[model samples]
Target: MRIVVARCQVDYAGRLTAHLPMATRVIMVKADGSVLVHSDGGSYKPLNWMSPPCTLREGATDDGQVEWTVTSTASGKGPGDTLRILLEEVHSDSRHELGVDPGLQKDGVEKHLQALLADHPATLADGLTLVRREFPTAIGPVDLMCRDAAGASVAVEIKRRGEIDGVEQLTRYLELLNRDPALTRLGPVRGIFAAQEIKPQARVLATDRGIACAVVDYDALRGIDDVEDRLF
Candidate 1:
C-alpha cells in the first residue's frame, strides 16, 4: 500500500465528471492496483476511487508537476473511467510494504456468521438446504447458495449487522443470478439477507425488493449445529 499526502488536483471522466481542486489530501494506492483519493474527513469511504483491474501511469504534467493517471477497464463504469491526478506539492509520500495479509480473522462478526450459516443453512429458513458457500458469480462470491424444499434457487447474503448496504448487495447478486439460464431453469432465484440484527430501514428496503430479511440467532444456530453433530 502506498499512501501519499499531497496538494493535488484530480479530475475523473466517466459516466459523470468530478473534479477536486488542488488541496492537500491523501491518495491511497491499494495492492489491487486501485487508487482512492480521500479527504481527512468523510469517514472511511473515499472521495473518489477507481477499483482494481486498473492501471496506473506516472508522468509529468505540462507544468512539470507529478501526474498519476489511473484507467479502469470493463468493470462497467463503462469501458474506461479515468482518474487523473496532478500533484502540485507532495507534503509526505510514504510507501509501506504491508506483506500480503492473510485476510480478516475475526471470530464473531461477519465471517463467523457466514461459516455457521453455510454449515446449517436450514436455520435461515425452513427446508432451505445449502448448494454451496462462496458461490461463484461474475461480480464476486455469494455467501451461500441454497435451495428451498421446492428447489427454487436462493442467494443468501450474510452480515453481522444488516444494513441498507447489505440488502443492496444481495439485490445485485439476485439480479445477476436470475439472468443465468442454468440457475433460472429451476425457477426464479430469490434472495435472503441474513444477519444478526437488521436495521428497520433495511427490512423495509428488503421487503420492497421482494427479498426476505432473516434475523439470525447466533447461539441458537451454534446449538443446533452441536445437536446435529451429536445425533450423528
Candidate 2:
C-alpha cells in the first residue's frame, strides 16, 4: 500500500461527476492499483476512489506541479472511468508492501453462525445451495453467496444481531453485486439478511428495500452433527 498526503484537487468522471476542490487529503494506492482519496473524516469511506484493475499515470501539469491520472478498466468506451488529481504540494509519500491479508476473525456468535450456515446453506431458504463463502465485491465481500433452484443468485449477509445498519450494509452489497457483469448473467441478485435476532424496524426496512430478512438459529444449526450421519 502507498499513502500520500498532498494538497490536491480531484475530479472524477464516470457513472457520475464529482469534484474535490483543493485541500490536503490522503491518497491511498492499494497493492491492486485501486486509488482512494480521503479527507480528515467520514470513517472508512473515502471521498472518491477508483477500484482495482485500473491504470495510473503520473506526470506534471503545465505549471510543473504534480498530477496523477487514474483510469478504470471497466467495459465501457474510451477511458471507462477517470479520476484526475492535481497536486499543489505533496507533504508525504510512503509505501508499504502488505503481501496478503489473512482476513478477519469473526466474533464468537458470528463465527459459529457462518460455519454452520456454510455447511448447511439450505437452512436459509428452501432449495438454496451454497455457492461460495466471502464472495468479493467492489466495496467488500458478502458473507455468503448461494443459488436457488431456479438459478437466481442470492447474496447472504450474516450478523449475530441484525440491526438496521446490518440491513443497510446488505442493501449496499446487493446493489454492488447486481451491477457486476459476471454475476449479472446468473439472473437477478437478491439479498438475504440473516441473524440470530433481527430488530422489528430492521425487518421492515429490509422488506421495503426488497431484501429478505431471515432469523437464523445459530445454536440449532450448530447442533446439526454432520459426523452422526456417516458414523452409522
Candidate 3:
C-alpha cells in the first residue's frame, strides 16, 4: 500500500509570519487498487491521491470551487480508469492531533480493547467469547482468543500489535477451525481480522472470501472519564 499526504493553505496569516492556517489530508491506495480517504473532521475540501500511472490536473477556480482532472499514464490515450475516490477533511487541533506513530496507535488500540472486554462482557457478539488460551504452536501462544461459545474451539486468531498478512492469516485460521471435525459441527467457521483499521484491500478480500472482518476503532471503548479528559 502507498500513502500520500497533501496540505492546502486555507488561510494565510502573512508571507513572513511564523503561524499560518494550513489544512492537511491523507490518502491511502491499496495494492488491490482501492483508495480510502482519511477525513480530518470538517475543515478543508476533499482530496484524492491518484494511483500509479495516473496524474492529477488542476482546473480553473469557478464559484469558489476547485476541480482537477486525472489523466492516464499511458501514451496520450485518455483519462485512466478511476479505481476509487474519497473525500476527507482536517479536524481542529483542539479536538484531535495528527501524525500519531503507528506503534503508539497499536498500543492504544490494544489497551482500549482490553478495557472494553473487561467492562462489557455481554456486548460481545454471538458465537464469540473471550478466552485466555495457551497454544503449543511453533509461533507461540496468543494473549486472547475469540472462540465459539459452545465447543470452546478457536475460530479466530488475534494479535494485539504489528501488521501481518491479515487476509492469509485469517484464511489459515478459518481453515483450521473448519477442518477440525469437532469444530465443524458448530457450523460454518469464519474469521475476524480485528484491528485499529482494516486496510481497503484486506476488507474487500475478506468479504469476497466469506470471512467476517471488522475495523475496530478505539473511540467505541472510551469511558466517561476519557471523554471528559478530551473535552476539558
Candidate 4:
C-alpha cells in the first residue's frame, strides 16, 4: 500500500465554522491494484476504480515523509495481509503545502507494528498477546505494549525511516519495564525496536541484551497475491 499526500493546506477557524480552511487531498494506493483517498475527514474513501474500502492497518509521518498500510476487508485474509506506502511531500503550513499530517507518520508506524504482532503471532514464540498501543511517547502514549502468557509484559518502540535514535528510547522502556513489578514478572523482560532499517547502535544493544528486535523493510511485505486476494 502507498499513501500519497497530493496537497495540504492549513485549517484555521474563524468567527464561526464557516471560515474553515479547505481540506487537504491525499491519494493512497494499494498493492492489490486498489486506491483510496484519505481526506481531512470521513472513512477511507475508495478510489473510483477499486470499489472497496481497504482496512487501514498502520500510518506514520516524519520530516514531511508519509507512510501507511491498508488491507482488503474480505474474509479469509489474515492480518499479515497488508500494503505499505511511503511518499514525500512539500511542507509550507501557509495553506499551500502539499503534504500529509506529521501525526499520520507516527500513526503509520504504530499500525505497522501492531500488524506484525497480529500477523506473526508464532514469531512471538508463544506467551504474548497485544494489548494497548500508542505512539510519539512525548505526546502521552507509548508505541506498543503486550501481555505474555506467563503474565509478563513487553513494550515495543517503533522508529520511522529517518528517526535514527530508537535504541536509547527502547532501552529506557526496557529499563522502566524491568523496574516496574507489574511488568517485571514478565522478566527477563525484552524490548523490540522495529523499523524499516536498524541503526548500528540499536542492533548492538539488542544483541547485547538478548532482546528480540526486528527490522521490517516495506518492500519485503508487499506483492503477496495470495495474501492480498484473501484479505478481500
Candidate 5:
C-alpha cells in the first residue's frame, strides 16, 4: 500500500463529474490498483475512491506539476472512467507491506443470521439451497454459497446492517466468483446482499450493479415471530 499526504486537487470524470479543490489530504493507492482520496474527517469512508480492476498512472501536468490518472477497466461503449489527482505539494509519501487481512469476524447477530439463512435459504429466494458456508475465494470467504432452482450459482453476503461498503464488498466477491467456470457453468454467478436493514444508498448501488438485496428478519428466522409462539 502506498500512502501520500499532499496538497492536491481531485477531479473525476465518468458517468458523473466531481471536483475536490486544492487541499491537504491523504491519497492511498492500494496493492490491488485501487486509489482513494481521504480527508481528516468522514469517519472511515474515503472522500473519493476507485475500486480495484482499475489502473493508476503517475505523470506530470503541462506545468510540470505531479499528477496521477486512475482509470476504470470496465469501459464499454465510451471511454473508461477516469480520476485525475493533481498534486501541488507533497507532505509525505510512503509505502507499506500489510500482509493479507484476516477479514471481518462477524458479530453474534451476523454470524447467527448466516447460519439461519443457510438453513432457510428459501427465505432469501424461492428454491434457493445452500451449497457451502464460507466458500473460499482468492480474496476471502463468501458468507454462504447457494444454488437456485434454475441451477444458477448465488453468492450471498450476510451483514448486520447493509451499507455501501457491504455492497461494494459483495460486488467484488461476485466479480471474482463469476470468473470461476465451475460456478458459472449454468450462468453468471448472482449476488445477494442480505442484512436485517439495508440502507437506501446501499440498495441503490446493489440494484445498479444488477445484484439483489434481501432484508432478513432476525426474529422471524429465529422463530420468535412465529404465530404459534406469539401471545397476543
Candidate 6:
C-alpha cells in the first residue's frame, strides 16, 4: 500500500461531477489498483474512492505538477468513470508491503452471530447446511457458504444491521460465485443476506435481485429462548 499526504485537489467525472479543493489530505493507493482520498477528520469512510478493477496513471500536468488519474476498467457501451488528483505539495510519501490479511472478525455481536449461524444454518433457511465459514474468494472472504436441500450453492452474508450497501455486497459475491463451473453444475449459486435488522430499502433491493433475506434472532440462536421468561 502507498500512502501519500499531500496538498492536492481531486475531481471525479462520469455519471456525476465532484470536486475537492486543494487541501492537505491523505491518499491511499492499494495493491488492488484502488485509490482513496481521506481528510484529517471525518468518519472512517473515505471522502472519495475508486474501486477496482481500475487503473492509476501517474503523470505531470501541463504546468509540470504531479497528477494521478484513475479510470475504471469496466467494459461497457458507455465511457468509464475517472478520478483525477492534482498534487501541489507532498508532505509525506511512503509505501508499505502489507501481506495478505486474515480478514476481519468483529467481536461481540457480529462475531457471535457468525458463529451461531455457522452451527445452525437451518435458522437461515430450511435444509440449509454449512459448507464453510469465511469462504475464500478472489475479492474477499464470504461470511458463509452453504448448500440447500437441492445441493445448490448458497452464499450468505451476515451483518448486524442490513442496509443497501450490504445487499449490494452480496450481489457482487453471487455474481462471482455463479461464474464458477463447479458450483454452476449443481445450480446457479444464490445468495441470502442475513442480519438482525434489515432496512426496508435493503429488503426491497434483495427481493428485486432474487436474493433471499433472513432476519436472525440472536437470542434464539444462542439457545436463550429455551430459558424461562424473565422480566428485565
Top candidate when judged by lDDT against the true structure:
5
TM-score of 2: 0.52
Candidate 1 per-residue lDDT over residues 111-222, each given as its tens digit: 8898889898988899999999999999999999999999989999999999999899999999999999988888999999999899999999999999998999887777
Q: Per-residue lDDT for 135-159 in model 6, tens only? A: 9899888999999999999999999
2 against 3, candidate with superior lDDT: 2
RMSD of each: 10.8, 14.1, 14.7, 20.2, 13.0, 11.0
Cα error, candidate 6, residue 160 (Å): 0.4
For candidate 3, what's the RMSD?
A: 14.7
Query: lDDT score of model 5?
Result: 0.93
Can you tell me which runs of candidate 5 are displaced by over 4 Å? 1-108, 227-232
Q: 4-35 in candidate 5: lDDT tens per residue?
A: 99999999998888999999999999999889
Off by over 4 Å in 4: 1-127, 135-140, 162-164, 186-188, 217-232
Pick out the ten consecutive residues of candidate 1 with the lowest summed lDDT: 223-232
Model 2 clash pairs are none
Cα RMSD of predicted structure 2: 14.1
Candidate number with the higher lDDT (1 or 6): 6
Lowest lDDT sum, 10 consecutive residues, model 4, at 11-20
lDDT, candidate 4, equals 0.54
Angstrom error at residue 61, model 2: 1.3
Candidate no. 3 TM-score: 0.40
Pairs that collide in candidate 5 are none
TM-score of 4: 0.41
